[model samples]
Target: MMYIRTNQLLKAVILLLFAVFLFLLHETGEIARFINPQYVHLSQIASILFLFLFFIQVPRMFTNSEDDLCGCGLWGCSHGEEGRFAMKHVISYGLISLPLMIGFLFPFKDFGAAEALKRGVQYQVSQREARDEASLEKNVQELLEQSALVLHRDNFVSSLRALMAYPTRFVGKPILLEGFIIEDCQDEKVTVITRFLVTHCVADSHAAGFILEHEDSLGGREEQWLQVMGVLDVKQHGGVLLPVIRVIEWEEIEPPANPYVYP
Candidate 1:
């Protein structure tokens, strides 16, 4: 019937549009804003696969009636829903298409300090084996030799992990690092320099960083990226000893191309 053919064509157009949407996200490299860098290759593969499926579905749009066989020319062909028009089906299709529409209309944003607050920041490190401790110390030493204990974006997660694990080992040692501001206390003199640590992807991202103690107020610095140079110091906070960064110098910096640090 003409009605069946029209519905089939509409479905095919929707499928084609969804495929194009995903393909564009991958092409623009904006997919990283939503997903982990490690899984970018998988997203790329999915985009290609979607486009391939769209091409296969294109033939259905021209057919005046359902084909007795699928694209593979085999028996037991299936055209999902087969011209059925029900509220449930319509709602389901709308839900499926909603994300595509939103992505097209809204600009992609990297997760920021507001998201970090909901997730909370973690800084404590647990005990490690003697051999592991030695290896970690050696690695830290190599980084320490690079003046002011500079931490690069590439190794930010691992280096911070090492520092957290062995706070005493790194105490009095100066460090240079970068992260966005996280409001932590009523007193505007102190704030947390926080990084989003993504173990697998953005879905699992968690805030990680050290408490920064500065004489200057942090009233207007919330969510702003800052490069901090300081010495690691142990301070008593809330009746517990915690590692704090005694900030010697800090400056506002532009956000990095890839804002999330992978563990």
Candidate 2:
């Protein structure tokens, strides 16, 4: 009886912890800090389910002593006379609760240029389909004809792709860009302007950016967000010729609300 009661208490606690985890994600509006913004509705649904389960477990703790809450005959409940909560059971639950405990202890952090460099930035963008190259080039030319080819959050990834795909077409064309600085090469004259390209979620996220070449060193600019108004210059870096920004005007800026750019 005592073992069953203890097991019920542990189960209730675990359910409540799960509920709180979901609640905090939504309450703090930090859900965007982890996953893509589009999937926030799914997180909302899961939080509701967890809260419902938590409430169900709360009443069960007082009404039933020997009843199995999980209802899985294979685990968590023992019906026999020798039934006892073993040390392994506690260890298993502890392991299950470890992630929740760690989340509470640490501040939520988003993956940035540091993680981008580790994954390696995509210097040259490629298209698998031939038609895409032509269409991308045409659209880029239209944009470049404007006063300045500005790259905004919605079309940032696509703009970079088009520019990288046809470097010569965009060479010397005035452009605008925003991203964090990442420097991996020995030379300090150039740095990568990187953004997290998240396809589905942060786990599948990777960094994408182009090289920025300037006469002055980008010292003390590491991991800082900046907006660059420049013209593309085809330059050689790491034996590959890619578009490098010849910066005309630049200034530091705050990181955007949604750091990850989606496809």
Candidate 3:
């Protein structure tokens, strides 16, 4: 009679599931939504490791009492009984499977204004302390030399930081930006165009963006995606100097497939 070890079988199954889950995330391009693309190769290596471990575990499932003994052939070195269930093992396995369950069951959604508010939206680069002023000035000079200043996911965080650090230098420079709107409660005509900056993964993501000023009312546009072409300007809000965009032309747009910016 062939007896399968329940514990070994469970481990094999979990390992296989983990491998599949990681592969699926990469295959569907959903991994970009979670981690920086540069570290994707690391995750791929992890999936391969899980698969190798699963294969190694497969043979252990069919081991009998004689096979369970260590190479020293001592009975005391035997692995625990095959069919025995332990609460500790169950709890450990459950904890391991929790992230897998959440990843597979829930769909990935872009962080909205409500989520940004919870994280405390950063409207200007000055909101953060401990900046390298010299480096920031150098970056701002390089950006100013460019004929056009466009903000995309790749340069979103850096450009905003430099521009906000030296708002006067960037003033009157035509710029383009895209992000979701976060309405300001204190000002009716002002709205924040916000993006989530992810240094490593979604867990550490935080809000960073520019405050936009429009001549017309910006009500009822909260949390909506927009593309704005404007000139950079400064505004004093809540007793802090902030870099603001004076809108020249703007339009509503659909949210991007991958909305998070990786720094």
Candidate 4:
């Protein structure tokens, strides 16, 4: 009888955690954009509910004298037969939940959410267009100026795909990118990391690629925007050559209005 009740209590806690996780994920961007000012009241109400359950469950768990809190069937809960409460469960739950809570905070805002990835590229294209407005006035000047026409969004995506699909060393090809200083590890070199953005949302972003030869500016503050001019170059690391956009000349720039790029 003690074991069955404890099992039910544990199931309730798990279900609560799962529901909260789903609720927050679904709310993603709108989590901050609360439409109702009274939502703060809603949050407080939810907090009260959690605290009420916690207060009850914790004491109950502490007082439990079950012979099988974990279970005793195919999944034997008999790891401990003692009537005394075990903090092992508490510690285990905390360790497990902490990371999952952190998971709720990803793909990280460093790169604007995945939507930003598409927008940043478009924004860049737009800025390029704005900067070139005067060239359209000059017929001969237009011929000399190689504007990065939106050839196609897919065309730009293909270049990114090439880098992703071919992670090996590459020789320099014409490349243009803008980002801020992550930290320059460059010595006689100018090693720096420009973000290769892949994001699902602003919360959970991943970064890729580095210009080691350009480590000269690697130690700059995190997330400083830079416009890099380079060619594709391949470097061998850990027995594999990975392609990198080799730096030619890099200049600092103001960050775009929308600052993330997604794959």
Highest lDDT: give the candidate number.
3
Worst 10 residues of 2 by lDDT: 73-82
Per-residue lDDT of candidate 2, residues 131-191 (tens digit): 5767777767776777778888788877877777777777778888899998865343458
For all predicted structures, in order, the TM-scores are 0.82, 0.82, 0.88, 0.40
Residues 1-263, candidate 3: write the lDDT tens digits.
Answer: 45566777788899999999999999999999989888899999999999999988877666445445232121122256444577888899999999888888987787888888788777666534326777777788889899889999878878988877777787788999999988656543457888998878888999888888888855578899999999888888777777888998999999999999987
Candidate 1 global CA lDDT score: 0.73
lDDT of 2: 0.75
After superposition, candidate 4 runs with Cα above 4 Å error = 1-7, 30-84, 100-146, 149-157, 160-176, 183-188, 191-193, 197-222, 227-263
Order of models, best lDDT first: 3, 2, 1, 4
Q: Between prediction 2 and prediction 4, which has the larger TM-score?
A: 2
Best by TM-score: 3
Clashes of each: 0, 0, 0, 42
**What does the lDDT read for residue 112 in candidate 3?**
89
Residue-level lDDT of model 1, residues 1-263, one tens digit each, is 42234444556667777778878877887776667678878877877777777677665544333453222222123454455567886887788778877888887788898898788777665455324777677766765566557777788877886676667767788888899998865333358899987767788888888898878755578899999998998866565466789888998999988788775
State in Å the error of residue 150, model 2. Answer: 1.8
RMSD of 2: 3.9
